[model samples]
Target: MSDRTRNTPEMSQSAASRRVAKVGLDSLDNLWFQVGGTLCNLACEHCFISCSPQNDKFKMMSLAQIQPYLDEAVVLGVKEFYFTGGEPFLNDEIFDILEATLAIGPATVLTNGTIITNRRARELARLEANSIYSLEIRVSLDGFDEPSNDRLRGKGSFKLALNGITRLVEQGMLPILTAVQTWSEAEHERMLAGFKQLLADIGYTRPRFKIIPALDLGAYQQNKIGPAVTEYVTEEMLEDFDRSQLICSNSRMVTNSGVHVCPILIDYPDSRMGESLKATTGEYRLRHPACYTCYLSGAICSNFSSGGQSER
Candidate 1:
């Protein structure tokens, strides 16, 4: 899932059937900004958020709308910040927003890597160069070649993404390439080899790869994808589980709508805690099937985590 899917029948179905597990905020270490909302250039089959060009359930957030959150994050002792969307680069004021964010702390923007022109890469490089904090650009390249990537993304997406990666590489920005896992664990070695070769084709030797898990949302929910979510997190599931590995245990995402529990659950109105960061310090119930992915995969949304990035 990407910046990610929303509203499904899991909650309503489980409401009366059973009690879902809940997680409390250990500490507000990470802050997420839904800068672009659900307005992505490409309508990827795997996006849980179901973000697309026409989907404007939530609108793009301006720097003015985010400044207060940035201020509040500092008060909340937020160690770092993350920027995600349908496609974060789709926003016009993205650079300005990053500039403002970098002034406070490190920031990472999750993008599909299709619209990252040479100019845009240079601007991002400048932002990273100017800041003492780290600026990570995570690009989602679903497959190694055009056929595979384009199948999940769109036609010609592989070429455009390669160009985007090339530009960023030329500017000395090594973006973390994220590919949702669509293959079996047995194919892991083969997939890694192919991905390496793909990066090599574009002169990105020693590329960092983060093979993310495909959550059962959006495309998966509609039977367009495999491994439907049949279970949810229960009290027994969290008995001895390390809650720190969960995003909701230490993160909150701010969208144009309001402050949500986490970036993954923003589509549900119940996920919206309140209008401010203070109101979000409470515990979050793990009702959605997406939580099962986090429970199984660890905090995939975070940069430094036990789960998420496979290597480098």
Candidate 2:
């Protein structure tokens, strides 16, 4: 975890049915594009959205569809852009979209690190080199070793992902390796140390990594691994809390369907805020179980660790 996110406060939950907190949009600091949609190459057991090769609940977004949102976001003073999906690299035009985004502002892509071929790495390096703004690539790996990671991500995923990470490093790109916490809190330090050693063994010294808590949705729910959280954010809880800690207060997601409240709740019907970014700049209610996760882990969607140990 980064120092900026250490020892942050969590939202207080009450059993009383008090008024739900309505978090208002503070500013459009970050804009996320569901470029790959819900289609992904690998289906991890703990995927919050349950994305798979066959899952098309949310379809991919084309450059044409994304340009308008980028333009609108620039006008709204969005500081950065993010691209994610089932697997962003699976999209045919993902590189083009990244290039376009880098032209305007810093961009980040959340990937599984399985599709980064040598040619792709070269192209990405070129794009990053040419852009005035930074281009960050966040690679998802559930565990440090094959026995542990492949158990969740899939067979042979560990080797393939490591190859991709090495290729990216060879291209002079510092990818942020991310993992969802699958072990107990007592194992965190050992896990972190093991991951660092694993990276070093692969010649990636001083690796940047993030540990995220798994959400009790999608695959986790289907597998009956954990019960859904029943807590809700109430008005009294936000009386003196930093409202900016909520992703809803500063971020919006653009998908093929429309603009949604945040990245985590795109599958929820009520999360669909509006048809456009400008129209969606209003208050959002914390009504879903995932809202409790976000409240406990402050803004677990941004690149920088605001108040949560999770998030890239």
Candidate 3:
């Protein structure tokens, strides 16, 4: 057998099944809205989709572009919605867009946290009170301190992001702090503890934390050890593959390009479902390298209500 065949353990299975048992897209209670699409202000070293100011493979979904889907998603029993982008705040119609979304169900906005303004905080507060549904704001901070985080994110991002979090706390909205797992197991506790202390120092006594594993895609190609070999989903592998843990089993993301398996694989072609949400629900072959990370991380993207930290 060639080295390619040996390396691509699941390639044969993927190629064979490419014409059979195609993954069917299903709409679940949770629907992901690509409100910001592919635009983000701060380009991180390991962003799976390679979100940057210039990377507009998928453009921002405007309020008009998103409302019909929101209406459809609600009808299909979508209880929660997630909003992400290059930087969600960069969208000119963000508040208006969020107000429309908040009216339906719970909404979670994933942001880098530097651009959140005082006015935006007040708007979020208003939305929280006005809407029967809940609103969660997740701030992505790669590390606890500036020195560690700045290098991965960019210069002056750590302090500005902290300011955003502090403002959210003052607004009485407890935003979740999200970090990628880069530290050793022994170091994680210390980092989270320090984060808790730091949040407390900022007067946010109760702070929620999540550590996400890096998905080896986009800019992460530089970090790839080697191309991942996907094993065939045999009866033996089925024993270990927990169906409930995979994001695609429960949710699908709708971007300008179309529906995809999940938010993490928007940029990957194999993950694309179809032009509409209806075409995207079914079993995926689990071919991408990021699938391995998801298998290990399990439900790392969901929001947490309680103020506590969990390993990704």
- For each predicted model, how many residue pairs clash, with residues at least 3 apart or on different chains? 4, 2, 9
Best by TM-score: 1
lDDT of 1 at 158: 86
lDDT of 3 at 28: 69
- The worst-scoring run of ten residues by lDDT in candidate 2 lies at 1-10
Which scores higher on lDDT, 1 or 3?
A: 1
lDDT (CA) per prediction: 0.85, 0.84, 0.74
Worst 10 residues of 3 by lDDT: 1-10
**lDDT value, residue 48 of candidate 3:** 68
Candidate 3's displacement at residue 261, Å, is 1.0
Better of 2 and 3 by TM-score: 2
Pairs with steric clashes in candidate 2: 39-86, 40-86
Ranking by lDDT: 1, 2, 3
Give me the runs in candidate 1 sitting further than 4 Å from their true place: 1-19, 305-312
Report the lDDT of model 2 for residue 22: 89
lDDT of 3 by residue, 1-312 (tens): 001122334555655445322223344656776777677888777676777778788888888888877887766777688888778888888888889988877899999999888988888888998999889999999877898888788889999999999989999998989988767788988999888988898999988887787666666555442344353333344454555566766778888777788888776666778776655665676665566567667776666542122224
Q: Top lDDT: which candidate number?
A: 1
